[model samples]
Target chain A: MSTVSTSIAPAAAPARTSAPADNTSFSVDFSDIGRSFTAKPERGAARGSTVAPRPVLRDVSLTVQPGEVLAILGTSGCGKSTLLRIAGGLDEPSTGSIRIDGSPLNGIDARCAVGFQEPRLLPWRTIADNVALGLPRRIGRAEGKSRVAALLELVGLTSFADHRPRAVSGGMAQRASLARALARNPGVLLLDEPFGALDALTRLKMQDLLLDVHAAAPTTILLVTHDVDEALQLADRIILLGADDDADDMAGGRTGATIVQELVVPGGRPRDRGSAELAELRGRLLAGLGIDRHGQARGVAATHTIPHFPY
Target chain B: MTQTQIPKPGTAAAVRPARRPIRLTSRRGFVIFGGALLPLAILLVWQLSITLGVVSVSQLPSPAMVFLAAIDLYERGQLTLYVAISTQRVLIGFAIGASLGVAAGALVGLSRGANVLLSPTLGAIRAVPSLAWVPLLLLWLGFGEQSKITLVAIGAFFPVYTTVSLALRHVDQHLVEAGRAFGLGGIRLFTAVQLPAVIPSVISGLRLALAQAWLFLVAAELLGASMGLGFLLSESGGNGRIDRIILAIVLLAVIGKITDAVVGIFEKWANKKWA
Candidate 1:
């Protein structure tokens, strides 16, 4: 075990030194991001058929400033998770480039940590060990131990440090997951519906916990959620991915997901829920999601009355 | 959905304690007592039938006759020697076969390359019964300890290998993704995530393999063993000592049952730990 720790020490050394400067150096840039795959044709289409390429994400361009919380909202099948995965360097975009801290991302983005929808805790390991997984290899044992303890405390899972993931509640498990993500002290934190599976009450608690964590860490966050209210609550800006307007622009009768609308939230942290600004923006965002209360294509028009919210 | 407080429908019933089920640990004595009842009743019927001449004493000896035969074998020191010899063979064979099976299963389960190269060949060998291996093994290794032990090992290997490999393949995908997200790859991922996840299944496989090992032991000893319980059984059959044959059969069943119970205990513990 000593030998194993020593072997990993050198590989993780740079990350430890670079972590403190995270907030200033952190930014995520997604330029002309496009991903497509060749899938088999639908079952009823034809026998031995070769279908056109299916594009999941297309022309998704955005720059997330350091310490900013950007929410990507869309319905299922809109490739919002795919966009986050690409940003995290888990998957590569077929058409464009992603940059982290102004450098082009080539492989797994060590500086960007991801929290998936499921808590994704390893069932065998204790919560601390799962959290310790993100610790850089080069850090000494003492430092790693301290960091893990601190993170568990930060996520309010100090009592569960020695407990396995299976022994903890779902909300607690997700908190451990958040602690694990923060363990690396990554410059960019990519969350793909981190609270989607929780109960409404638990989701609210987690959203509050996320706010507290951000206040402490101040890292750039990219949250992917379908919940309009959640985006209004947590994000400084919200981007919607959907089909392009022009039928001619859509190949194979349907277009890939793109950044069709962007909304800049008006209020600061801990804003009132009953505020009229948020209420009107919520209506416009809902309309953009194709649920117009007026029963017409008035999504763009709805946001015009909200003076503070910018597109 | 009205909030009227008129004893709120099933509130009284819901608040009442349901009938408490007996816990397993607390019921251990009861379980043992219940289990012994059937065998005791069978033994009584056997003894009564023999006394009444319902079962011919020559063909089907009473339970007392078998007990006396066991004591006779014990006095001659044959009982201990036979049991010891058979047990040593099983322990050695099980150790060898179980280790190899687990290693092969891990290799094949974790690697598509190993599965492609080795699965078809292993699958064919696995299909061959323990009895089928007896003749070939005897021809190769002779009517000695080697042939019998090898036969037992072969019987034990297939179940462990097949169950473990299949279980490993079916490990939850969500856990695998979690491992990947945490910078775990290759061997680390397998050990930290996949292996622990499949431990319950592996323990179940071990229990099955152990049972298979014992089944093959009898077949192996019957073909050629000079001092095993199986040998005793055959020798008694030739000598027409029906009681001694029954004694050997009873000993085999008792040992098999005890060993299976031991493995079952481990299986239960593993499931609790890894559940």
Candidate 2:
């Protein structure tokens, strides 16, 4: 446990009670990240299919700056989740590099937190107990309980704090999960479609909650999603993923295949949600995603870079 | 939908009442009470049927007849002596068997390399039932208390091993990865995450192993030894004292019930506290 504390002790900025650092920049450089393995998979002596495990991710490289949310937009089966895992140190790439805050990330660290699309709260724990799980041991039981109370309150789940995960609604479970991720006071958050499991209204509410958390901590966040409108609404920049051998170019290291271009916007925060810039950007991303006016997939598609211009 | 409030929204009173009588509808209490009633109901019916002469006197004795024999044995001090002998054998055997089984289960579960090495050997050992071990135990340890305990240990070993191994194989990959990511590996990972997660399954296995221990308890006693419940049953059977035999069988049932209840309690406590 102390080793974990040491591993996450970033020299650039200490973890803070409220304000971490006045610094406004953070960045990650993932270079040539890839992985492969081999296994029999079956456990029979008589007959078993043996095959060389293939690569789940290739030399995927990207850079994410601090206080900026990079929405990684990708289609299913294009290894978006795999890329996210590699970047978070949840997976070791077969060949490549990953640096967070200029320090190499070899394995999981306390400075980073990840939330999956599924609301993966521990079933046996109440919402508050789930939140307390990630808190540092120095807090002790009483303070840990209080910290859990505060996080649950922040997530608008004070009433459900004592409720087991099984008793809560899907939206409530996701909120509890978000609160758990927040408990570690992470600097870099990896959200894999954090609100994908929620209905539209709940998703919007979760989006607002996420934005507020970002405002409070001002942490560097890398959010992944397949939804183009979501990218337009939340990200400082959107990197579109395509299923091609040259997909590494859109990530800023290579240039061969890209459908939706990567473009950086100049916005700091609090961009107008209903402004024409956002709407126009949404339309372009929607087109890139091949979604039409009826909120359905479009027949026509185009590859134009996503820019972070604020109006 | 305003649905959250209509449910008589109370303070955390819903979960806090530590001494509150658990609702019968709640699964925990229901299982507890239902479990308690089964044997009592069986005894009541048996007592009633025997009193009514519904069964032949040779085949079925009234519950009272067994109770009277138990009192007679108690007065003679045979009950205490036999019960003590059986209890000691069970405890020692179960301890040895469970520890070995857990060690083997862990070895099998963690490494593919280890599984390939151990599976065929365990397969042959598991195929041989505890009853089949009686002759070997008598030959190995002599026809005394030692043989009896060895039989009980063999009975306990296989179930614990099989269940623990199966549960380990099906361990949640996500939790393992989470533990690894958190810098927990080698021993710490097993103690904190892997072990806790596998506990519910292990408890079930222990429960099964304990029942097997009881199953072999009689066989162990019957094979050798001059005391214990199983020996008492055989001794009574020799004299055609069916009432004493029935009493001993009833005693075995009672001990089995008690051990099961204890294991069940431990399982519930483990799941609630750690799981």
Candidate 3:
């Protein structure tokens, strides 16, 4: 934890100069957050029938320090994305509140910028214009233009500024999406599987790019991803969300997901992927997600070697 | 390796050099010539039929007779007046109708309350043949430009309204959400996301409304009006002058095609910009 804090300090320092006043990284607090969605009635069901409210997230409480990168790790449908959405104010919690920098979040909080899994770019707009959409309403035209240009440069998409979203490759489009989210200099950036759609090689490159972006902006990041290696790679802290078996039994079965495991990743920015420590943590996280390690845990050498090519 | 590299540019030059120049001028000329082929063939067949005496001259006048009728109308100075009046009415009616369609479509498309309140009644009104509005409009506004233009406007409204509202409603939800997330709402959101997303559909709607405008113009002129192509057709029919009737029809076809071509050009530009 101390190492993590020391590592983030250097990155957070430059963020103050780069980001607008009072718009730098802000702390996020999720206290007793619970969200329930009413299940749609089945077809041919009687009219005016009341349906039970299905809980998706219950009692999800966490406090993220400013400039911290927190990864919410969970399997699909485990309400991790829901938690991130609640923090971004894109979705409201049924119970409890989310406070950003000590202020309670309201509808679509301006302090938070969300990068959705899909690029969600306006198809007609150029990459530059799409990024400009994130500019604050009061920003001057000249300042906004420079900000968009700077963001494109940051994302290494300056050459493709005039290109439409469909004209670019998937990785390039995702980079533009990230740049757009950063255009507002968001106090808290919520990323929901931002690179989930990319090919493996591109995903690795994007993860590195994200680390660089964090170093530059250092906004409080809440990333929700199902990829355990991704969590190990990018997070200062990793929180695993899953159903508590005992609590689930008491609630009659699978009520909602809450924090099941939490770990302070034992390193700074750009941690070594091949480290034995992370391999153990990865095995543990995969187990938490009900995935078998297949004798791949730390200190367990493979009995059979991978065959060489052209063998 | 040297031979491959040397031949690469040779092949590229062979493929590229003539393609652009050909596409620029001669290809376009070829397309235009191809388009005219059918009409020219029809003209030949009509002239041959007349020369062979396949049909009576009184029933289907020779192509020359139709040309003479057009010249007669032009010499009398009525041809320009008729075309001018018809074009003016169609343009004005289309403008008023398309503007209202966009306004109403945006309202209904964006707001649930507006959609619920307006769409049902508008849909019902659209079902009524626009020609049916003529009798009521004549009663309300009398036998004047008001009644005729109103009929054309009615004709132009539905297509634009339907297309605009549907397109706006179906503008990608993800894009709208992203727009909303970035502090855009109301009119800013509309212009930034919703409007541009649906521009192709709106232009298509405008084109359909223009065609409908011409259709309604003829309907209005056929029932009333002292001038215009429809008036010319009806008057010539009454006088048993088939040539004049045929001339009015050819004039209507040419004018309609010209107007549609104008909108088609605009559509091409818009699709390039927005789609």
Best-fitting candidate, scored by lDDT: 3
- Cα-based lDDT for every prediction: 0.81, 0.72, 0.86
Clashing pairs in 1: none
Would you estimate the TM-scores of all the predictions? 0.87, 0.78, 0.90
**Model 1 over residues B93-188: C-alpha lDDT tens digits?**
887888789889999998889999999999998888778888888899998899988988887888889988999999998888767766778898
- Model 1 residue runs over 4 Å out of place are A1-25, A41-51, A247-252, A294-311, B1-26
As a whole number from 0 to 100, the lDDT of residue B148 in candidate 2 is 84
Best by DockQ: 3
iRMS of candidate 1, Å: 1.7
| Clash number by candidate, in order | 0, 8, 0
Give lDDT: candidate 3, residue B214: 96
Residue range with the least summed lDDT across 10 consecutive positions in model 2 chain B: B2-11
lDDT tens digits, residue span A269-300, model 2: 45555565555566666655556644324422
Lowest summed lDDT across 10 adjacent residues in model 3 chain B is found at B1-10
Candidate 1 structure quality by residue, lDDT tens digits, A1-311: 00111111121212222335433326778999998755763524442347666778888899877667899998788899999988877777879898887889866767888999999887767899989988865779999999999999988999889999888999999999999888888878999999988877788789989988887767778999998878988888899998876843654456688998997787676556567677778877887788755633332323322223231
Runs of candidate 2 exceeding 4 Å displacement: A1-25, A34-59, A136-150, A158-163, A244-260, A265-268, A293-311, B1-65, B272-275
What digit string (tens of lDDT, one per residue) describes model 2 on residues B1-275? Answer: 43233222353335445344344356586677887798889989888887788997778777787788889999999999988888888888898888888888988988788899998899898898667888888889888777887788888888899988888888787766655544457887787567877889899899999988888888889867798998998898888888899888777878888889899999999888656
Once superposed on the true structure, which residue ranges of model 3 sit more than 4 Å away at CA?
A1-23, A41-49, A250-253, A296-311, B1-26
